[model samples]
Target: MKTKFLLDPNITFLNHGSFGAVPREVFAVYQQWQRTLENQPVRLLGRKLPSELRAVKSALGSVLNANPENLLLISNVTFGLNLAARSLNLQSGDEILTTTHEYGACLNTLKYLAHKSGARLVQQPVSMPLKSPEDVIEEIWSGVSPKTRLLFLSHITSPTASRFPVAQLCRRANRAGILSIIDGAHAPGQLEIDLAEINADIYMGNCHKWMLSPRGAGFLYAGSAVQAILEPLVVSWGWNVDTPATPEMGLLENLQWTGTYDPSAFLSIPAAIDFQRKHNWINVHMSAQETLSRFLHRFSESFNIPIAYTPEADPYIQMAVLLLPPIKDPEKFQNQLWCKYAIEIPCIEWQEHQFLRVSYQVYNTEADLDRLFSAIEDLMPSFLTTSSHTKSGSL
Candidate 1:
């Protein structure tokens, strides 16, 4: 599996959550699109690209259970949320509710919009060691009030790697007349997603992260009910709003084309989707879970650092955040792992605490995680103040 990707074999890359490794076949397809576009730019971009994009959307739509007409191929989740946040006409005293675990960029988008509209962006803190998904639903919904006009949240939180109960939350938001916009950056390839079942007003996800595609491959989905409310980020040729002179042009016309831009990545959606289908991602997901579960158990047993996810609720899947023992300098610890161990993972700082995030994809194995465990054990003594860092094993 690792050979099928272009990632360096010298590095133990456990950070697929950051930017996904593209399959060789998908990369070939992406390159092919670029070459084909250059062959006849006008013939393809002006004439055939729209129809080709419709096919890509159709394939992706089937995977997401969303109408192809409702989806638009975008650059990334950040871009998609930006469009959604700015389009919502919030008034003074209106509030957008979210959680502390959301990706910072998405939160910034909401914050900027709220500030512009004289509205409030309420970031509700979710309790750690969650008891159940119901607890999550309650924690976020408790932030809602009559002032809450929208609920913006991550399907799978970036920092913590916890999958929120967005579907249930969306259902709840629907009852209260609050719009739901889900940042599904980590949801599409990691889990089985159904946009219709989730029923969010707007959803944005990246194919580049977990879907085994190149960078700049992402999409935004807006249900027909909220499509009319969206405003394009760039005022290009397709900025036709609902005017008497022109019929209401949907997202296809309004935000699809911005200018002369390279869309090879966007055109590679079908290849990415096909790669997953051909690989039996279901079995791959299960295998990754099994390996991740073992590593989580062994590391917790040896290091005495409790895993972030609640054991029973288990809101997490492959990606995990382990709160590290206090270190003099978090950057040094991370640097040592890369420089000495050749391990590629993220050392995160969230809420005044340092965390080590692990993201194992299909290419990873138990041996890979075992190497991580051994490296941490070998290096822990130098990083820790005391010689011990464990509950019963050592410290």
Candidate 2:
């Protein structure tokens, strides 16, 4: 039996990693929230918003194992990271150490901060053909030094789709007195997240990606110790000369409601959580993982490509990146996949190698993989071949 969602069935949607597709039931609840707000905007935003927000935050906190006080809803991981990067106090000669496998936007965000703070942004090169997660930890940690003030890394890498050993890295950073900021854009619903156990200074995740929430739903978690250092991206009415009775309450008042935007997306988080729980999200995840592993085995064997990360190192989530032959232009190849084949996988160029990333969700099935497989098979001989056959040089 196949699952139903708001996605169009006509297209083979293999790009759930980019922007997740929300289920119809969950979206219906989201729309209902929107309708409720539209009915009486003044009442929803003024009279009842605070209580509603507290309820949503409490539910999200239960799932993340975080204090509702320390958590603040943001538009996305980018928004949260931007706030953290801007709020931190970095001195000149300080080094911001990170891996080269991080998402491009996040790298840019760090670069922007480094440039402003007069600190050097050092990217530690992590070679592929990785044996284990320990290799990743060692490679990334080797760059840390007395000059290193902060360590920023992705829980699951973007381009390579390899899951880094964030917990181990966080422990090492803590021991060395370095602040850790983790970009968990793909982690929340994809994996079991225990914020207390991981214990990073700041962690940001996207609900839209794996949590199957509405777009622009994300949260930033600040450890109690570091909460004082975090400044809202947009300074609004929340900033005050005197501290409020509750720091968490102050954070919600100041940071959560930034200049009157729609809170429906944020309100729908509980519904997304309930939808997944009622449907047994773990079973859905395991089923997707099994199918993805099978498809990956077949696809890699057919194309003579090796798996970039091991199952033990990076277990199957909603997404995985397969290393492919280096292409001259990865963006062009991605465009071809979309325009010619209607296949929506992401082709990323990382470490001079090309990667074809596929994302599987509850709405995806074996037939979807079969379609992608058939498309790649058709493209391999004529388009992906080494020799140029056409004048346009697409093949």
**TM-score of every model?**
0.95, 0.94
Cα lDDT over the full model 2: 0.83
Model 1 agreement with the true structure over 1-395: per-residue lDDT tens digits: 88998889888998999988898899999999999999999888989988898999999999999889889899999999888888888999999899998898888888899889999989999976555898888888889998999999899988888889889999999999999999999988999999999999899999999888899989999988888777878877777445411225455546888788999999998999999999998888777777777777777767777766667777777788776776667788888999999998888877755678899898887777878888888987777756234422311
Alpha-carbon deviation at 259 in model 2, angstroms: 0.5
Per residue, candidate 2 scores C-alpha lDDT tens digits across 266-309 of 99999889988888989887888778788878876877666766
Worst 10 residues of 1 by lDDT: 386-395
Provide the overall lDDT of each model, using Cα atoms, as 2-decimal numbers: 0.85, 0.83
- In the order shown, what is each candidate's alpha-carbon RMSD? 2.4, 3.4
Among the numbered candidates, top TM-score falls to: 1
Clashes of 1: 4
